[model samples]
Target: MSSIIVTNIAPTITEQQISEFFSFCGKISTISLDHNTAAADKSLVAKITFAKKEAAETALLLHDTKLGPTSVVVEADPTAPAPAATADDAADGELRQEDKPRSAIMAEILSYGYALSDKATQKSVEFDQKNGVSTKFHSFLKDVDDKLKVRERASATDEKYNVTGHLHDTKSTLSRYFEKALDNSTGSKIRAFYADSSKHANDVHKEARRLADMRTGKSPADTPEPELASSAPVSV
Candidate 1:
């Protein structure tokens, strides 16, 4: 009951800014941002859980007003696990309508388009351990456009984000691990992970490059995805 949802946030807004903005409500237990990459605007949404119930109440008071730069809508999280709910409440089917369940990568994608934090890097490893991650990344790339195309016209596009930089950095990090040992030959799980991760990296980078071209008036064909500082050929 101490959670609230903040919507229509800018992608560039950081967790620190979100925390500071909501500090008036008291200690915050967690802050998570959600992004819709397929959305033309690519605005972010955040779910914050306050340590104290009253704190969330205090923040919800500012709902509908632009109390912070990134937040446009602040509302109660009716779906938060209630401390105690009567069996009658359950029988009545009093619940939030979850039109879409969140995916494991929901919190991960927003980490890109910016510098890689330790948390983001760690999350990458966590994703590797989770099942169906490669498929999810593939789907993400498809939404991003498999060819890594940037469909957003220059006029309709907002300010350019350094998506290429982040992807490049992430791939470089992956390459190092992929090349960590010469013994990691074909059929190695690590090798497969690297191959899949690198492919997605390339997919994301292609879109980033195209977006860059659109913004700078460069011909899409004239530019290539930025080369990673370190890269390795995958056997898998």
Candidate 2:
């Protein structure tokens, strides 16, 4: 098989984000993202066709792995017509890892896009920079920033206080404009992101502090004001 089927996809999952996760395995020929993912109670699917059979085998390796916080099923594409369901097969039913101990409702898909993420996954996925639909966080933020102008406002606010304040790292800058992109951000997603101190953990932590330092690092206000020269002659 040169293709794989991913099921139980959160509607929020985009084609690009999924590609980022799997592209490291091999060259992908095509990725078909579900357009009707918004339908409730329906689990979406994504079909990935890789250039070679080896890629499909490697992708099937993630069959039981977590996609974000939830477990999704990945399997090699059977490529044949659906089999007629027997009583036993129907009784068994399709089981997904996320279905176990299922919650009262499906959890909100907050896996946020994969771009600008300090995660090691970014080191692998190649993204198209031209499209607003680009998987890179910059593109993601750029689209969001258009209406809210959050980055514009944040940049203005920063310059208003300290004219020279700037973050050289573009990704971190975009992260700042997005405002919620820092390490101190708390939530279930962030907590999982910080799981067990690994190299990725250290990298995110260190990068967060680095981004924080842009403002907290130095202050124009800290410099002493130059003494004012009086136009009036000094008293003899």
lDDT of 2 by residue, 1-236 (tens): 27788887776677887886666444577888774365464656888987655445446645545566555678877882332332321123222121111010001111112222222222211111111121233233444446444344454435422112322212333333334322223322332322212223232333333233334433222322223121111110
Error of 1 at 41 (Å): 1.0
User: Which one is best on lDDT?
Assistant: 1
Tens-place lDDT per residue, model 1, 1-236, is 37998887777877787776565444577998889565578878789987656456555544543433443677899889753331321133221111001111211222223222233233334434443333433433333332223333342233222233322223332222223211223214323433343334333333333333433444333445455321121111
lDDT per prediction?
A: 0.42, 0.40
Model 1 clash pairs are none
TM-score for model 1?
A: 0.33
Candidate 2 Cα errors over 4 Å, as ranges: 35-40, 80-236
